[model samples]
Target: MNFETPSVSLNTSPENESHDEQFVNNDTLEFKYKVLSYYNEGKSINQCAKYFNIDRRIISRWKKVESQIFQTKIKRKRCAVKSIIDRSHFPILETQLYSWINEKRHQGICLSIILIKLQAINMFNTIYKNTPESSLEFKASNGWFGNFCYRKNLVLRRITTSGRDLPKNSVEIIKQFFSENCQYTKHEFFKDWQHG
Candidate 1:
């Protein structure tokens, strides 16, 4: 009754872009950076806020976020200081993606990160088509793919299906066994087994 589970390798290589860099040049983040930069360069916060037609409190918050933005820009690339999850992902989309992945695996398909990401993008497009949001960008970046794998306890690698070693002719043996059994009734097969 004992069994074993096959081991799988996790994809640890860095993607084309750092996860932090995924948010680079985000309009809102860049706007905040510009606002803070202008403020630092002799413009008042109020003036920057008025110029952007945004609230002063938001400006103040961005001011507090200035250091984080600077650090992000310096360390890697421009990134949002405050993570806005509004467009990060759609939960239902991800759930459907997970199911799709499982279905593919069940069909003995080995899916890679690139394939999964592409599938995610395709699913997103298909599901949201005809809606205003369809035009919105959905990169299905490696970060999101990795997060999806992590959440679903899935790995992005070749599926390894192994079991206790059997004789090399196991397939033929199985076929012969089934063929023999098909020619016999239950009573005769078990009567022979009882003798064996």
Candidate 2:
């Protein structure tokens, strides 16, 4: 089968530039198919690499893992990378944590980072209750908590403190103040106001 590689553009702008920019080859799958076809047709690895504009080592490696890469029942959707949370191990943890967070938030309780981390540890321990202590994998460390927060879009905000004790009428008082002083300049108000 003939394979056509997609055209790649090097379009970039100063504003869009990033320090951690990655070079993404969009035609990786096409390249793999082309390499496999060429190799099977008795073409030399060097010839295939030169024709495809791919590295010789990459072509050779692809050839070595040809069966595993091409003949697998389940095709890989993403590049192989380590995830912060092993979803396979803790399948229900995300759903459980999401519900727990929602319940706590609905009850008007703000969760601190420490409290969230503690809760995660508790949840992990509960899930692995039957497993031996030595075999327990989840530690619910600070790093893990950070990843969890990022994944769940849970932001931890600092609780603001005020000096004066605010009454229930504070919102009404604020609205009244704004309504009364809406048109007056600060200088005009201070100059015209009588001393108490």
Candidate 3:
């Protein structure tokens, strides 16, 4: 009985040849599996190059690093994505801000984007009170706010407005109640006031 080894073809088009070649080169795991498969089947290095459309030098390098790759499970060093605010830049301020947000959340308060931006500005001001002229200014721009929210996995939801019209004198009644209540000082009453 006679047996013949099966032939493998990359079947790449001229348009996609470079793209496919780059993918195979970048994908270490797939390349390793292919190399091992061809080697096990008694295929030559030149044969692998012709079938896989990869360089012979790359195949030699892969062979040299095969043991290390298998040992490390093909782990690759990845560069971490940078954030808008670095903790190293303003460590204390960031820590305080994080704590304040957690405290507010624990109190069951819903935060809006505007509210967060305002609070961030306040915190930045308070932390840098002595260094007013410092170059490290925190404008708390919309882009920075957005990135902060993303980094913290916090979602800012808008308050739903009621469409119904209020009765005439509702504002007067509210003002009267606030004035009569000893718990609300005149300053606090006006500060928390919202007119519809």
Provide the TM-score for each candidate, comma-separated: 0.36, 0.40, 0.39
| Alpha-carbon deviation at 78 in model 2, angstroms | 15
Question: lDDT values of the candidates?
Answer: 0.73, 0.68, 0.68
Better of 2 and 3 by TM-score: 2
lDDT of 3 by residue, 79-169 (tens): 2223344544555665677778889989999777777778887887787888844557777788877766666667766769847788799
**Ranking under lDDT, best-scoring first?**
1, 3, 2
Q: After superposition, which runs of candidate 2 have C-alpha atoms over 4 Å from their true positions?
A: 1-89, 132-134, 162-196
Candidate 1 local lDDT, 1-196, one digit each (tens): 6576535435433552364355344346566677788889998878876555567887787777677766665443444465433343577788898899899989988787778888889999998888877878999877877777766678677647757889999999999998968877889888988999
**Candidate 3, run of 10 with poorest lDDT:** 74-83
Better of 1 and 3 by TM-score: 3
Candidate 2 Cα RMSD after full superposition onto the native fold (Å):
16.7
Each candidate's clash count: 0, 0, 0
Which regions of candidate 1 are displaced past 4 Å? 1-88, 158-196
For residue 66, give model 3's deviation from the true position in Å. Answer: 17
Candidate 1 vs. true structure, TM-score: 0.36
**RMSD (CA, Å), each prediction:** 22.5, 16.7, 15.4
lDDT of 2 by residue, 53-121 (tens): 567887777777786557544455334323344553455665688789889999999888778777877
In model 1, the worst 10-residue window by lDDT is 8-17
